[model samples]
Target: MYIESFVEYNYIGEIAGLLLSGLLLFVMLYVRPKKTLLFKYIFNGTILSIVAILFQISIIKVANNPDQYYNKNLFGIQLISFLLVYNGILYCIFSYVNMMSVVRRNQRKEFILMYAVLSIIYVIGIIIEIAASGLYTFTLDGIDIRHFTRYYISAGIVCAVVCFIASALNRREISRITWHAVCLFVPTSLVVLIGQMIYVVKAHYIFSATTYVPIFMIGFLLFHNVPYDELSGTQSIYALDAYLMKNMGKKKIWVVYVILKTLDIENFIKKDIDSLYYGISICRNLENLSPSLRLYKMSDNKFVNILEESDPGKAKLIIQEIRGIFDKSRVDLDVPFNYTIIAGELRSETDTILKVRQFFEFISKRFIDHNSSQFYITKESDYKGFSEHYEISSVIRDIRLRENLDDERIVVYAQPIYSVGTGSFKSAEALMRLKVGDKLISPEVFIPIAESSGAIHMLTCIILNKVCRAIGSFSEYYDFDAISINCSSKELSMENLNRDFMEIIERYDIDPSKIRLEVTETAMFENYERANKNMESLSSEGIQFYLDDFGTGYSSLERVMNCPFKTIKFDKTLLYKSLHDDRMNDILSYMIEVFKKNGFITLIEGVEDESQKTYSVDRGFDYIQGYLYAKPTPIEEVKKFFNRKSSF
Candidate 1:
């Protein structure tokens, strides 16, 4: 070969080597590089290849001809060439071992032995080159003629063996480019293997290209997808988002919500798990029918969407289907998972991403606030103004931080519970007040925020503590009967709810019987087993139990039969609607009678005037709780309430 053509031919080889070396480094970055002894060889191997390229360039650019300046440096160039080949092989060896680190069983052992054998074959090829081509020769240059034979032929053979070994380690992940290289290299490596029967350098170049396929593919793969390490299969939430984005573009987007019953799962497995796949299955079930709906994982427990194609009627239908799945489940937890999400079709799109995210944030907050049961949706405008008020709400939060802050920001108020026969105030339900400095804010203003941020527990504790303390103090002055405190279902999970209540009652020396606990149907179902147990213990110690909003929330006759409650407070639904609706009247009559026969107390709620009052009196309610007696009042005003009823 002529000098210029010789340099040009090998330069292509040098470029291939450089790219492969760079790719090897790139792949190693995410593969969790261990500070191993072999990586040192791999590093040196790849580095010296750069020196070989520099030596070639210097020979072409700085030297005149073979017999001129470069001839004296032939030994140096030759050594550099040896180092490049040496390092390239070492890199392949290291990468193969690193790649196979995760392999299991005897296959891993077999792989290690195969690489060891390939290394031995490389040594034998070097010995063949030494014997076949003289070890050194020079035409104005002292050169190892055999080195070229060994370097090209030996590497080609090693590559073919390694390629076979590496191909066997294939995983058909769409994200892996090594597999792509195997496809390209395997045939070429075989051709090179056939060509090696006759020792010719020209034939060696064709096989050499095949041998370097992995390095080229690897370098290219560095710029592309890396499976599991650099990039992994979508996380549950991310997968949900990707699916939604892909399917639904600008349209009435709808979401498929899933609730996971992971309690048993968490108990069964101790290791960290990517549970997104199971969650995706839930979306898959929903999409199996309503294939076009967009979805996104709002959180671990919730996913949502607001496609441009969605309508309220269609949204409702999708929600019902998802719910029917849970409703029919034979295993309770599998049916009703820990997460209950509301998927609202977003109708509030504007021109901005911030608006979109704000809309999503608003959607998520309202969805979580929905609390109980089933996949569902609501219009964005219904909640838009509600969140809009938060512009002024932040200032109120600072006011809430003041001394006796909660009390200063909130006024404690109570609504009287009436004994129907006696026409007297028997007990009061404590409600929170949010005040801006001197102005009182309604419970509706902050309870949702408190609940969402997990501040509800602290707020609940404070309110209950104050109510108990005040009633205890009030008892010292007057013969106050008793007080009722509303508890969220979440409160039942307090580490020692029984002990906390016991301590409060014990601290004030208040009779546990004098303290009644009211829980709404909205909150009654969760922690039912633990709640009922706690209530039983409290009742055993003398506390009273009242099931609030009885006509609502899991309100089947089943709860009346299954739940342990001394009293049922019929929801405003029953009392307000009973007058005109005969069916409601009949149901109310049936409910009152069912409780009466069971010796359960019935409290009619939401009576406003004589018309509703007359209906409650006719309905056989043991008691009533509503605005008819008086709205929730301050402690100072309780005296006036009792005095107004003094004539009784």
Candidate 2:
């Protein structure tokens, strides 16, 4: 076949090679793949290729102008060219093997041995070929070009065979591009070498440019295609998402959110090469427990283990094994890192992918301040309406971002609190409710949002004002004593605590004596002095104060005594425990007596049935507040239904 003249084609190939190789280097540097070490070696390999090309150009210039520069440097140039091109190929092989070692953990020892053997072979080849026979190349016209020597052929063959074997061994473990690299790299390189030999025999200067084409292809094929983290060898978050989505219904998946407890996550990620060692050690420990635990790194300090059909007990054992890694008495690593791991487990059913996503969303918001590193197992029962939770979170985010709540969206619910003995509607506790387009958001969901976003104070004020308006309206029909409103610790902590309470109360022009304020015992303990001051200040204004959820706190009696409470509402947990124990029942009865003697009205919450109500009233409870009377209802509904009941 006829081709273009040697001189023209040679110049085109050289210029084309330079431009393409430079572009490869630029792109590689720009992307900055995770395997920085591998990137460095590839970078060195590229630089060597460029240097070999420059040496060929220099030799061409000197050969043309025979007396312009020293001719003796030609041998040195050839020697250097041989060394660079030879080691450049070796470096490529080294990077591939290293990647295989990282992806498949057990192959590390075999990889190391293979690497040492390859290194020895390359060094011996370079010393024998370059130092003794001096690269075995000849000048074509004026340009010093390259051809395959016995050393080059032998070393390349050994490297290719070993690489092909490594790729075959890790066929399933490595990515498609990596597999393609293993398959294509050796053949392409051998083809280039053969072309170099043919071109040199035909007296052409094309080998230098042609040889680098395969190297550039190898760089693009391997570096960009690697799918796992360069440092940890764990699946990247992106890869995990894709895998989970692809195998959506095929696996019984459980995600274990792993967090490092001892060291700050940012610091752990930023502390140089130690991060790699720590990650490897943790992964090793996890793998030792169960090979099916596919670990993925979620962030700098958080790892996720995706298990197929793994039970909670197995996950717990894996966490325990990881924790044992840091124990000085149990195991010693080369670089012993000070890190402790805590894991949270959530299982996903076939149709519950949305639930897992919602869980991830919830933990993302709360996990930073969570210092406890214990393993927490979460099932569907823990968060039944996962989509609703996600919606609530989005609502919270919107609320926080907007910082203005539509008062129309805020609601007040009231549950009737009746007298245990008379079965009369005595009073009702005003409960806070929020709704978004008819979807009622539980206080359990939005209250935390309020507390976190500094909106609890506003929420309390809204509730108090709404209750006041509702009570004034209800008073025209019913003979109830008062409508009690719940106050949060955030509301009590307000600097204008007294004024805030009175501003709403006085606006409604309601009787202060008829308005009761219920504060949780735990709320008072949050800031005792401030809570006491707020309670005393409100009490001085003729507002009756009740210590709500009394037995739930550590110091119930102390709170009542320090704060001037008119009543102490016993939590139902106390009642439930007293059921099986006669001693507990007696002690509860005695406590009620003691409170009544001290001028404190004792009320028991959670009276669900007639028997509980009878038991409580017989035990000296001044009032009973629970579903035995009614669930929380809107003010309008409460008026119509209760008026009928009273008439009946």
The C-alpha lDDT values of all candidates are: 0.55, 0.64
Please, what is the TM-score per model? 0.51, 0.61
lDDT of 2 by residue, 1-648 (tens): 222222312445556666766776776678765554456656666666667566555544554444456366665666557555656656565564546434543455776676677677777766666566455433333323333333454565556666677668755555443555557766776777566556654655454455544554465444444445433446667777777777656655666666555445544454534444454545555655665667677766667777665466776666566556546312443333333343444434224455565575565555556654344555465555554665665565565556443365668888888775566777778887777777787798888777876777777777777878877776756666777888887777666879977988888788887789888877877778877888888889999988888777878565577677888888998987787789989889888988888888888889898888778878878788888778889865666534433653
Which regions of candidate 1 are displaced past 4 Å?
1-361, 364-410, 435-449, 493-495, 555-564, 643-648
lDDT of 2: 0.64
lDDT of 1 by residue, 1-648 (tens): 222123212335546655665666665556664333334434554454445455544433322244544454564555445544554654453454334222221255675576577667665765665567534344333222334544655565656565555555544221133344455655665565456434333421322332444543443333222211111111244444444456444555554444443445443122222232233334445445454543443443434543344467866776777676545432332322444545555444422333344444554554454445534455656457544545325534444454232344456788877887777776677887765556666767677665654556556656766777776666655544677777777776566788877876787677778788887776757766787788777889988888888867875677656766788888888776778889988978987898889879888878889988888888888887778678878854554444233333
Residue 52, model 2: lDDT of 59
Candidate No. with top lDDT: 2
lDDT of 2 at 402: 60
- True-vs-predicted CA distance for residue 531, candidate 1, Å: 1.4
Error of 1 at 138 (Å): 11
TM-score of 2: 0.61
